[model samples]
Each structure stands twice: as C-alpha cells, then as structure tokens.
Target: MHAWMSEASLDRADNRRKVPEWVSAQWRRPGARLLLVDSDGQVATDETGSGPAGVPTSGNYNAQLHTFLGLVDGIPWFTTEGPIIGPSASLRHLGAVTGGAALELTVGAVALTAWHRLEPHCSGCGARTRATAGGLTRRCPVCGRVQFPRTDPAVIVAVIDPDDRILLGRQSSWDPGRMSVLAGFVDAGESLEQAVHREVFEESGVRLREVRYFGSQPWPFPRSLMVGFVADSVSAELTIDRDEIEEAAWFTRADLAADLAEGRVIMPGKASIAHRLITAWQGRLLG
Candidate 1:
C-alpha cells in the first residue's frame, strides 16, 4: 500500500464536536478511551510498541485541552496530555508499526496536540486563546477572533529521466549515504504542479514534464500535508545546487541495488512517501 493507514477508518464527526452537550455525551459513553500525548510530541504505545496504548478515561485530565478525536469502530477516542503509561514513540516510529484506525487516531492526536501547544495565543491580537469546538479551534476572548489549525503543504516528487533512471539527492543536513527523492514546501501563490517543477529545478536544475499526483500522507511533525508526485525530467544533466542539495545523481535500477546492498546508500524508511515514490520507480521494494 502506498499509505499504510490512510483509509477512512475513523468517523471524524466535525459537526457533532461543535455541540457541547454531544461532546460531553461521547465522553461519558462506555468504551470511551483517552490517548496520552507527551510534551515531546510522542504518543503512548502498547507493550508490543506497534499499537496505541489508550487509558480507560478513568484518571484526572485537563478537560479543556481534551480534543475529541472521533469514533473508531463505534468507540469514541480523545487525546490529552497527561502521564504516559508505557513507552512513548514519535509518529515516524508509529507509522512504521501500526495501521488502520489506530494509525489515523495517532496521527490526529499528535497533530492536534502539537497545534494546541504551539498555538495557545492568538496570532492577530497577541491575546491568550482558549480551546473550543472540542479543541478544533481556539478563540481569543478579548479580540473575538477564532483561529483554526494550519497545515503547511509540501511537494515530494520521484523524478525519472528518459533512460528510466530515478533522480535522488542528498541534503547537506542528512546523514551520509542517506538519499531520497527531491521535495520542497509549496511557496505562496504556487500550485502543486508549479511547486513540483520549481523545487526540482531549484535543487537539482532539472526541468520536468508529465508531473502526476501519486498520493498524500499526513506528516504532523509540526503539521504538514505531504503531497507526493512522480515526474519525468527533460534531461539527466546534473547542475546540483550545493546549498540545498549537497550531491545529486541519476541511478539505474542496477546501480541503486548495488549501492543499497553494499550499505553505500541508505533509503528512507517504509513509513515515508519518499520511500514509496522511489520504490515505485525502482519497480520493487527496496527493503
């Protein structure tokens, strides 16, 4: 699967959350659960470390910050910060381990919790805002301004040339031998396709055509929607930008296999869309 847990497993009752009484009813419902989000932006994990470890909604918690996540298999789920019961892990690690509704819940919990922590004050009035709408929005009491959660859009593309070789680059900050497809944030006043073309040229100096949407993933490290794509480059000539891309090169399937086998090239993990994009071009799984 391109996205392991990106299906509609949870019913996000947006309208229901707007009603205070309905939200309270859900909280009192039997089988209601609470997932703990830590200060480090990590979620509590089960003993196996592959699934979420939700408490029985039995302990003390800051109800104001308790965000209603929605229902998974007819069970209500909410997220709030409290004592982590067991081991905690980041979304990157959780993505690699879980699937289905659990993955969706964890993603939502992390994203909403992080947003709540970061956006406790109003951007417009510099006044403290309170969480409302089941933590979906924050309202400034003094300014009467409501703030919504923000998600930054980014484009990640797997670029292929006429020879069927894939273009991969290494960022200056990345570890040695680690490489992935070209990606960048969507600039203001730019379309997704335009961002794809601009990012490829700005980083690797390769103009692309046949740009196609591949898939998308919710990367909530600090809230971002990763839009994935595949494109064909006009030429394979390298004009690497040393500032963004430390090194870039075209790789045939054979070359990639050899490098990976020898531990000379470290591909992204199975959790990221970058891995899916590269493997799609490679015509098989890399790991």
Candidate 2:
C-alpha cells in the first residue's frame, strides 16, 4: 500500500479552494470535529464544537481553521478543522468528545493550522500581516516580506557496514532492546548528506562512506521534514555516546528478522519515515 493510504488523505485541490459557504455556515453548527494538539513530542486528539469565537485571543484559545485533504473509504473529500490547542475557556462549550489516535493526524496538518494563525503579526516590525492567496502565505504590510509555512529539515539514517550489518542506536530513555536509526536536525550551512554523516559519527562513532539518499517523510510531530539515507560504515567498531545514545552496534539481517518475529524489537511508527527506511533495507537483504 502507498504510504499515505494509512492516514486520511488531504487533497491538494481542497486546500487551494476558498472555504465553501456551506462550511462557513457551519460556524454556528452544533457538532464538533476532530482536533489534535502536539506540544514537543506529546500528542493529544479530541473534539471541539466550533472554531474560535473571536479573532483577538491568547494562550491556547486561539484557533486557525484549516481545510485538509481527507478520504472516507476510498473516495476523496475535504476536511475543515481547527488548529491544535488545549481546552480553553472560550472553547469550553463544545461538549465532551473522545480523543483520537495520534498516528491518525499528520504534523503537516497541525503545523499549517498553527502557523497560519500565529504569523498574522509581522516578525520584523510587529505590523499586522495580511493573509493572501487563500491563506497559503502572509504579506507584511510594512516590510513587504512574504512568509510561508516553515519546514525544518532533519536527517534519519541507517548506517551499514562492509559486513552487511546495519547500525542501530538505543536512546537512554527508550525501552530496553529498542533500537532506531541515528537522527538529528540539519544545522544551518549543512547539506542533508553532511547532516547524515555528522549525526552517525557523533552518536555512534562510526565514519560513513557511500552515502546515498532515500525517501523523505513529513514528520509534523512539531514541524520536521525527515530525510532518510543509507551510509556505508568505514569502521565496524562501536562507540556509543552516553549523552545522546545509550547503546550502538551492528546487527545482521537475520538478527533483525528474528527480533521482529518475536516482537523483541519494535520498529518506529508506520507513519514515520524512519520505519520505511528500515523496511527498505530489510527488503534488499532478504532478497
């Protein structure tokens, strides 16, 4: 199956169009729709009655209504929902609704909603910016700076050795025996390839060669674009960085398959680009 089929599809066409009159008419609608919030890495999804009541609000009360590409069954449709935020005094009237699964919501969906609302005021001069192009961008009236949604690039890599073993690292806070690829945010003035090599060396003390790019995923946990790669390890010896990683080592395909079969090793989330990278490597080895 395609990577996006698991999550609700947010059609691009829907996002381009103006909010339909029928949807706006639902402003006074009684029922609420699904809303999800993410602070750091923690996620919470719940229902809210309607969009924010007024424009000028503070704390978690502010809301930016977004139209997302969505699907019901195999048919494509659009969804108009509020941004991610906790319960506020202004939104208390929505009545109680159950929380939804975290994986069901995409980071793109949440970040787009929040950025649209927070950027109304210009960063340069505090002058109020005007929304343009159907909420896709903001134009600063004073400085004339056009601002769009921000996406931070990150690198998540699987380090491979000449012995055909894959390098994995376990964070100090993660459960025992759980291992994942070394990852870090791409710093300014660095390419994705540079970030991959630096992160692997810093976390596991493994020098890499033959670095090749893999696919990317929209990891919106809080606005991250995950760039995946496979790098050849020049050294087989392991050196774990206690501050960032608790353990680092090379594992063979047989070992990984055994662990996966016994549920001893847990892969990253299916929604995560990391999982897809690992799965791709496994396929090649098994073949």
Candidate 3:
C-alpha cells in the first residue's frame, strides 16, 4: 500500500474520534523525543551537544520546541521541534546519529524537514522569520509573509506504442540496470499535458500524442507532486539524449515480466509514484 493511503486511512479514523487525551499526554512526557534541525541542513541527534549546564556533551538542545498534528491523506501526523540555527555547532555531529537518514532524526521526518529550513528568512524582505503555529509555517514579523512547504509538480509518463510496448529510460546516475519512466518538472506556464509532451520529446526525441492522465501521487522525498500519464508514441525512432539519459528503449509486456522476475532491471522503488504508474500499466497489459 502507498504511504499516503495508509496515512489517509489513519487520518479518517482519527476524525471520527475525539482528540485522544493520550495525544496531549505524550507532550507532557519528559522522555518523548523530538527531532531537531539546524541551519546547515543537518538534523540534531543524541551524539553531540553540550549538557544543560553548558558542559561539552552529545544530545539535542530541546528547549523552545513547537508542536502540531494534522492529516495528510487523513493520517494523524505531528511535528514537534525547534527552529534551525544555520551555524549551530551541534549540526557537525549529525553523522554520528542514526546512520545519516534524515527521516530518523526527528518527528517531522524528511517530508517536513527541507521546507522548514529552506525559507528561514523571508524571501520578500530578507528579514529573519520565525517558525510559528507549531512548525507548520514561517511568519515574517517584518513583511508579514507566511511561508509553507513548497512541492514541485512533475509529470511522469509511460509512452506506449501501437505494438503494446512501453518506453523506458535509464539515467546514468541510477544504480546498475535500473530503468524507469521519463519524468521532468513542469516548467512555469506549462500545463501537465504540455510538460508530458515536452519532456518526452526533449529527452527521447520521440513525439507523443493522445496523452491521458492516469493518476497522481504526493512524493514527499523533499516535496514533489508526481502527475502520472500514458501517451501514445507518434514516432518509432529512438533518439536518446546522452546528456540526460544514457539509454532509451521500448520493452514488450513479456520482457517487462521477465525483468521483474529476474530483477535484471530495477524499476522505481515502492515509495515513488513512478512505481505505482508502471505497476498499474503492467497489470493492465498482462491481465
């Protein structure tokens, strides 16, 4: 199941009940931990901090933290942490904590981490803004600009041919034998369909037509909205752009199934919308 769906179900269930007293009680518990973030884009952990008396130590400075709970896809989630200090000394020791997974550092995890640190100062007036409303937003006292999480909307399309083949691309940066759908961020002033057509043509040098929207997913790997689609290949020629993709090719349904079985070609991971789109398409064809 997708993380969003699981979280949504939890959220829907929470809505029917009263705000549990235990939820509030957890806030009062002393040992309940919070993930701390610093300005250098690092998370605070238990490995490096001064003791309460200012002695050299290894733990987070947990005072003055914020707290909030909300539903994403109806899941009950909470964030309780303090503002990030860019030059804080505590940030240097983050590697010693939790093996460098940012998600493990704090309650907000990876989804809420980047946005909170990205806009610490107001972009409009260049004045320092304060994290308010329990880390849900940043407010500029000087310019009164309220900032929230920014999610880049991107289109991921599976181009299909009249022969029932799907187009896939392999990027140089990916692990060995990994292939996935062509995807790109929706440029300013371009519609989703326009982006799908533009990116596919640009990367693969193949024109597309009859683009159809499949579905969408909220990819919170630092905030991205993935819009999935299926497009018809108008041309058969493969013109791969070496700069963007190492290889582009068409695969038949049988070939895809074999790849899945042998793990010869790694598809998109389960956390991503790309995986969902590709799996759904494969089911439609194989069924």
Residue pairs with colliding backbones in model 2 are: 9-69, 10-69, 11-69, 107-220
Model 3 CA lDDT for position 163:
84
lDDT comparing candidate 2 with the true structure: 0.59
- Model 2 per-residue lDDT tens digits across residues 1-287: 13432534433334433444433333323332333433333223333433222221212211134333232232222222444455321211211121122222334435655566556788888888765543456779899988877788999988888888888788989998787888999999999999988888888888987788776766554467788888888979877789989887777889999987898887765546667667778888312
Which one is best on TM-score? 1
How many residue-pair clashes does candidate 2 contain?
4
After superposition, candidate 2 runs with Cα above 4 Å error: 4-107, 117-120, 285-287
Which candidate model has the greater TM-score, 1 or 2?
1
| lDDT score for residue 4 of model 2 | 36
**Stronger candidate by TM-score (1 vs 3):** 1
lDDT of each: 0.87, 0.59, 0.61
| TM of each candidate vs. truth | 0.95, 0.67, 0.70
Q: Tens-digit lDDT track for model 1 on 212-265?
A: 988899888788999998898899988999998899999999999999999999
Question: Which pairs of residues have clashing backbones in candidate 3?
Answer: 7-75, 8-73, 11-74, 35-106, 39-86, 49-58
- 123 Cα displacement, candidate 3 (Å): 0.7
Clashing pairs in 1: none
What's the alpha carbon RMSD for model 1? Answer: 2.3
